[model samples]
Target: MDARQTWSSQLTYILAVAGATVGFGATWRFPYLVGQNGGGAYVLTFCIAMIVIGIPMILVENAIGRRLHINSVDAFGGMANGKKINKAWKIVGWMGLCGAFGIMAYYMVIGGWVLNYIYNIIFGNLNLTSVVSADLTASFYDKSIINAPFAISIATLVFVIINFVILVRGAVAGIEKAAKYLMPILFLLMIGMVIRNLTLDGALEGIKFYLTPDFSKISAKLFIDVLGQVFFALSLGFGVMITLSSFVRKDENLVKTSVITGVLNTLIAVVAGFMIFPSLFTFGVAPDSGPSLVFKSLPIVFSHMFAGEFLAVAFFSLLMIAALTTSLPIYEVLITVLEEKFKIKRLKAIFITLGGIFILGNIPSLMATNLLSDVTVFGKNIFDAYDAISATIFFVLTSLLCAIFVGWVLGDEAKKEILFGSNGAHKIINIWFFYIKYIIPFLILVVFVSSFYDNFIK
Candidate 1:
């Protein structure tokens, strides 16, 4: 235990990080967002944001983690080897840890819903049929989620324990191994769904709508949505990239890894568009069903198609895999901090973290039902309140602080370490530094403020 654990290889690191990046953000949210917003235009905006904002921040986080060789809190706590700077900066890491835990709380609830869907499919409990309208799907959500807290709790516990077993095994054997297999299977499932959907009659119409850029639909709102999606999709501001990079061997090229992971994440999201849009059009289903696209509408599509039961199983299975991969890293964010900071054993850290999340996180599940349905905070229910706090507020604030810290405080030291073994290191670092210092931070602030305004005031 004296020696720090590191990923066995660069490939494992890529797969693991990609697994984290490609979860619900790409697999679930991206497709539906494309359907809701201007399909091709939203995708294009997302790509640009990924380059300007996503890649640089990712590199910054990875650089900080690898350079500090510590958990998120201490990573910021020891910046520039200065005591006062370290003490103040530690708050940044704590904010990130809070964001991670906050996200995990509600995220596990959604993960449980996916688990329930998979179970219903297996047990033939869901009598899905025909293409459901947006309202109908919305009604389904109202009828379903959190109606049975016992069942939801069971599913949540199952999800948490699965993560625990994987995390308890340590970095390479646990996370890397799960990512190596799960990522491939997830991709295969996506490819299969896309191919099957494309083969359906009228599928091209959906694809056309998705790929055709309707510039008229582009608005200020769409732009903000794209930026938020890119940030959330890349898992920025969560200290996840930082934690993941801490396990990376020092010789790995941070820029190369960041670019690869970012590109892979975007590509998977685009491909998911092909899968979702085509199926929606082919089945005569409307595209802009918001969040219900996956849980409610997609299953309706499956119910009407050939081999519906099999496809339904595969689709939900894909979601479960995506959710599991994403949740594992967030769990690690807390477990790593607890183990490193408190000097607890890994087993002890896992239980302590899970116990806390288990007790505290499920409040969202309760609020999802009639018991606390009338309860509201900041104009949102408990579940949405948690999401806004973690996903929007904390995430954006943390990313802004990270950009400022790397751009100004870490300064030359970070630049040198980040560029250490790469070709054209100086030029690349200059562009990255420019974005990290000036551009990315500003965009994060805009996203942060706008999100608050839209969620609370406007």
Candidate 2:
């Protein structure tokens, strides 16, 4: 995307980044991870990690994207002067694209679940079953497979319309206005839920689980996941942020925006944990599990907590918006690339991505299990395999390239762009370079090297 065609105001771009960063990584996923990682202790550390490691990386991403006016792939390559990195750097872009779209493909399916629950809630119907454990929905629960695909289809159509209408309308008309409206409403609804959760019976226990620290679980893997969450949440390496930054006028502050977006994003995750964890105790379920804890466990747990259908209605509504905010950006990145590279109409690009994802999205929809499985080079689910590949494999490579680009090749322009945007940011920027150049890459290397790769070549 041309710098001329992106968001106009700094705030809009920050909101757009906020929109991208603040969703699944925070909402259900945040609580779920805390549950899995040994309760509030992990949650506390994750938040701390976000500030220490995530913030600088976000600045790096925003600066790199804004300064280069190119996606990370091309940006990384052009920033380098040595060997031809054109091909190698392009792989970063492709991996980012794959990761974003791949996530959305499955995500739309989950988003559909939220939509289905909304309909079921508003209509005063519940898909309750006696034999079905609340943790796992009964056999009847392929609601996404049934209703979600169509819902996603419609939503994707609407998303395309909204995105292009904004992109075409220019920054003020489209991006800023949308963010100004959408982000506040999202935060408001979530905050209200958090306030409500605070009064619940088991809320404090849940809070501690989410906010308190358990030191033993802080291992290399936990840190790695935290690092990945920072990257994944910020929409880095994918060129989405780059594309968003493209719209800013040169004077717009990049560093402050990165920090603002990071703070807001992390705050939401913490709030989400506060809102979600207490519900586990309120409903009498273990909160120590991750995604499965939410989907399989929480539904049943909520059934026990709230009166009648009110719980389902509230939880799922927040979820739908959360999912939409995140998923929208996935398509945004694709649309930006397609429109720029193919000169295709924005509408056409949106449809192509939607349609392609709709089909690929089904591999999970059809399977009785996570699509991450069934993808076996040796013997792991496609879901786990992909998670490992996307987060660990691609992330390590991308971080290596990004660090090398920012710290080694693009240092001066990066310095100028970051310093121009904020007060006392250069010190952080210097530390950022230090981490990217040595610390982060080293941590990522330990993750990769220590990882016992399953024999699955496929």
Candidate 3:
């Protein structure tokens, strides 16, 4: 492989990773899950999981990448101490790559929805300034976007092309440059939304609902949900962290950077809760509205607020930025695989990967509209099937293998990479190692089985 591309600076690395970690999972999925699973209880469990499980797994991926310093596929098969471990371990990296691709395929469909919303809002197609009723808002999402095949497909194509443009520029000038701008704007939009939402009447009630813990609501199921959320929200187990970290400077502190990435991810999810719940309550909408919370419910809330159109624009723009930042890295994982493993040129790899994604993405996009709405895989539509299989199976399985690889296989070598620039913080390093080695794998196993039960068997 050619000399690996490193981030231009530590700050850029942090921002890039932060962009990867903090995507729609934090901004879109977390709030709804908290509402459904018991607000404060879910948030608390998610935080604990982030500390014990999320951050440690992140450190493990970083260690693997920095130590191996190859693309995800080749990295696993690459040398460790001048010897190759079993090539079967390469499956773990492939799983991560496949999982990332699977996710990006459907993720672009949703990204298209965000793009559609932004365009419609800007063009007066959505008409938020008018006295739109809840039914009208819901209908707009259902009829105009979700069920509109051409609209959704075009938007998805545009979103994919946007990612392609940025990624084609390579890591330093492309991914890092986008992150340098997008991450800050994402935070600013999020904060602005939170400030605006909190000022609404009855906002305090939503805040209370979000923060006041109901201990009685905690359960094994809730914990399982929290586990899945933390993993997905942090973008772990997908080789994203590993691929991004492969470019890190040798002396950078893995522990500090991983923690910072994890913290920023969790912070965005929490802030999303604050931004969303207050608005939901203020508008007399149920917080537990499932995935539609952002698409259907929020629009209704925005229509009633002062400067509702501007807020709608900002909110969807924030969502788009989060989506784009994340899509870039996930898309890069595939591009890197082609470039490193097949010796394909970067430009050719970009076209090949994007073409595949667009083709595969069409399945879900068409399934959402009248064109292929009847199509089903494993008794679920293309979109839900992708989401279920990726989250419940591929994600957990890859994460489990990664934990085993770093914890047991790499062992002390991995520890050395993690501790390289930390000035010998042995105690913390040991603690992190313990969780990665033993606790995290075991916990992921529980989540794996439980996820199967919840998603498939049950």
Candidate 4:
């Protein structure tokens, strides 16, 4: 058997976890959600949700993994000796694994799109002008992304190959090293953008829109939206925290680690709001552009900035780094499962996983454009269908099961994990347990039902 692997330090573990949490969403989707949802009020709700729900669950997932010191699937199965534990609970782990795979299948396509844009900017294939319009940017996306199907396929393959190389190198050498450098660079670039954005004329107007709370916007949907953001933004519900924590040294302070990771993730996302909204308002652009906020809308702003070419390079570089950091932990989750369950050699397992993703992912990439545009699953194209299944159904279901398992099934053992080394931790653990058992699961169920309605029923 292979010798056990553990993160060299708490810092590296935190970096890996934070990296997983900070993806493309941190750059674009988060700020957009804040704008559309409730701005400052949404931010306030999200922070509350993170503290009450997100942080506790992070600790719970880590405790399960560190205590068991195994892959997610076996963590539940190993909760008790052999057949004593309900074997069906292991399906929670399977759900997580499947969710990760499903997300990655389409996620790589998005990553490729980022890469293609980066290439266009650097190589002058995309002309960077002083003034750009939404129409112009839309045309560029259509020509480059929608019209060029083979390019996307090649990009996806390249992305899969890149992940395979890093993953095959093992965690410490691959994930840890990448996060150490990439994360800092990502922060620096974001800070630069934040400074540039704040200096823009009418920047404060955007800041006002972002910071001033409109409490009336708070409602059932607001809570649900904030809950979903808190859940997904922290990379919860995917066995990722479990898989990553399995590599953490037991004596490490998981409480501090969880808090720090959650705070940093939220901070970056908030700063991303500053990076986007201020410049958006200064350029006289609307903030409600949704997914196009990143690719279509941002490019117009980028063109208007001083030394726009250099800023564009930095922005895209930051994006690639963000995508890579997020991809690492995801790859680890899938690879660890393959390594444990199939007893396959690490290299062989990497190839097997990548080969499968490469083949399955192409279908989504094609459907995103011309070839399979007519294909629909429950009224969604192949790409959107995969996204809905993973994000809405599998992700929420896994989180609910995790809360149930830790709160009820593990019972006292779970409490011990939460309260392990702290003085006066019992009261806090009690509050956490109550929330996890009752409140958190119910909240997740609301999101699950809402998602189901939007995806299938509505």
All candidates' TM-scores?
0.95, 0.84, 0.97, 0.95
In model 4, the clashing pairs are: none
Give me the overall lDDT of model 3: 0.85
Q: What is the TM-score (0 to 1) of candidate 4?
A: 0.95
Give each prediction's root-mean-square deviation over alpha carbons: 2.0, 4.0, 1.5, 2.0
lDDT of 2 by residue, 312-364 (tens): 56667677667666666666667667776667876677668767766665344
Query: Please, what are the lDDT tens digits per residue for candidate 4 over residues 82-169?
Result: 2357889899999998888877878788788888888898888776756777888899988888777788777767777788778877
Badly placed stretches (over 4 Å) of model 4 are 80-83, 421-424
Which of candidates 3 and 4 reaches a greater TM-score? 3
Cα-based RMSD of candidate 1: 2.0
For residues 169-248, could you state the per-residue lDDT of candidate 1 as single tens digits?
A: 98557888899899999999989998999998989899889988899889877877787788778888788998998887
Give each model's clash number: 0, 19, 0, 0
Computed on alpha carbons, the lDDT of every model, listed in order, comes to 0.82, 0.63, 0.85, 0.80
- The TM-score, computed over Cα atoms with residue i paired to residue i, of candidate 3 is 0.97
Candidate 4 lDDT (Cα, whole model)?
Answer: 0.80
Q: What shift in Å separates residue 350 of candidate 3 from its native position after superposition? A: 0.8
Question: Model 2 clash tally?
Answer: 19
Query: Model 3 over residues 1-458: C-alpha lDDT tens digits?
Result: 24777898889999999999888899888998998987898898898899888888888889888886788877776555557788999999899987887788788888988999999989998998866777887889888777788888888889888888898789557999999999999999988899998899889999998998899999988987898888788887788888998888888999899889988888889998988998888888888888878888888888888889999999999999999988898888888889988999999999999898788765555564567778877777788777888888888899899889888788788878777788678899898888788788888999999988988887
